[model samples]
Target: MTGETIGSDSADDNDDTLAAAGEFAVIDRLVAGRTQADAVTLGPGDDAAVVTAADGRTVVSTDMLVQDRHFRLDWSTPHDIGRKAIAQNAADIEAMGGRPTAFVVAFGAPSDTSVSVAASVTDGLWDEARQLGASIAGGDLVSAPLWVISVTVLGDLGGREPVRRSGARAGDTVAVAGELGRSAAGYALLHRGIEGQAGFSELRQRHLTPQPPYGQGACAADAGATAMTDVSDGLLADLGHIATASGVGIDVDRRLLDGDRQAVAEAAAAVGADPWEWVLGGGEDHALAATFPGALPPGWRAVGRVLDGPPTVLVDGGAWAGNAGWQSFD
Candidate 1:
């Protein structure tokens, strides 16, 4: 039984599971009344979606989130999971200094899952995609043992050169847009089962859904950013990529990140963990980090400076002796 309300014409299937409601009915509920972006000349119901790349170049990236690996149903709703999936994938496109134009999603879940739940997830995807002025051009659904969400994003560079990770120079300034460490802090609170705190609720919510700094990628590119990347990995780990690719050293001043540490200080105290670790070593925040040749743009904050040396990332001129970031294997 579905036992969930989706506010669709198929509301009668609220108590019906995916197996009972059938695939086409569920898909109709998911795509009904959704408007496509101008870039999407052809959307769902077509054999293939046609997206416009006015610059004659398309930036593409894909990501997959498995149940209990990237998220947990007990802690996140289907809608939250959907938004998280789209947001994370869009960040990759942003990292290349492009704007997302279209997305195609594939979802796998058990047949016993409620149709309403699946519809909610689709709604979440559309909600987030709408924020980027993009559309869910097309997708597929299938039965599986657990919920697996895979999303592929297509973006346009708008005639600008794609900013790569290897372009950072010795004298460039390392800057960042958007907050950090909230996701890790939220995870810590949830893992410890801590609750009813004043501000911790926001942190917990952050773990479920990240708020990436949209539009900042194109802004950074317009400002002549030398190198750019999103903080899907920890700050140190992501910066390490730029350092390695550019063959330059990077030193981050801990003091510059005091605001982030302060934002999670209370949660850290309650959990007996170092906020610095979360601020520096945490991932999934999806913040934009980049290197600029001169003054950073208005929304960007100066965090460090690229150095002339062997490729490495240092915090306060020393190697950070904490968990650097997330790893798929270990």
Candidate 2:
């Protein structure tokens, strides 16, 4: 708690910058208790803040995006990166059938970077925060070789139990509530130097700035979703998470993904790549996926069904033999 500023007290103007202040100094300045949402009992300075849930259940998830590994400064502005980072992390909370209440961020950047860039990044973070009526709450700063952003989100259950991935049973319908494959298509368009294409241009933008379906996760929960997850990884890979977590089998019908596949088909063809790979195997879409026992609520579309037997994810009643999506290590 030492050296942590009390209020809007701006520190001494120095060429020192973030690096000179050191990691802890910068973090102390950033997180020195301002105001917290009613949901957070303890804010920063602890190992982890204690977030209270109405039903005594806490929904938590973490995500890390490396500069080159997850984003490129050449393609995405700092603002876009900030929004995407927050949006994707919040989507994970939605997948658990909860609403994000607070977020704690850890950011690493080069010392020579301008303060304007960091301010733009903060603007993006706050911009996205207002979307869910949440606030930045607390954060940390550190010096690194390249930019690295990590966000941990805390969510409230609103008195409802968390919808875990291991609860989907056979006969449950598989559904999605957000766009799929757009980011991947956009990435392809950018990488291939496809210029002057309207659709590809939109796809490229989606790669830089993803649009997560806010509130849809809680909607699924209220509708009695048995299992759910966000498509941070490929559709199959993410569903595989629910399958293993819930001890159920998931089978995706490719035909059901007709809309998703077609949405990026042209870009795939232009890049001489299979659209199904993006549809079935591409990651970072952050779409909401869940198992519904009845008619899905508005903004959702059914794509498949839960299956009996082993915990696995299948495509068209068979195994999908494609690049199973990206991973930290090959």
The TM-score leader among the candidates is 1
Q: Please give the TM-score that candidate 1 achieves against the real structure.
A: 0.96
lDDT of each: 0.92, 0.82
**Which candidate wins on lDDT?**
1
| Residue pairs in candidate 2 whose N, alpha carbon or C atoms collide under 3 angstroms | 166-246, 186-203
Each candidate structure's TM-score, on Cα atoms with residue i matched to residue i, is 0.96, 0.86
Q: Per-residue alpha-carbon lDDT of model 1 for 1-330, expressed as tens digits? A: 222333344455346788888989888888899999999999988778899999899999999999889998889988999999999999998888999999999999888787878988998999999999998999998988888999999999999999999999999999999878999999999999999587999999999999999999999999999999999989999999999999999999999999999999999999999999899989999999999998888899999999997999999999889988889875
Residue 71 shift from truth in candidate 2, angstroms: 1.0
Off by over 4 Å in 1: 1-13
Colliding pairs, model 1? 2-15
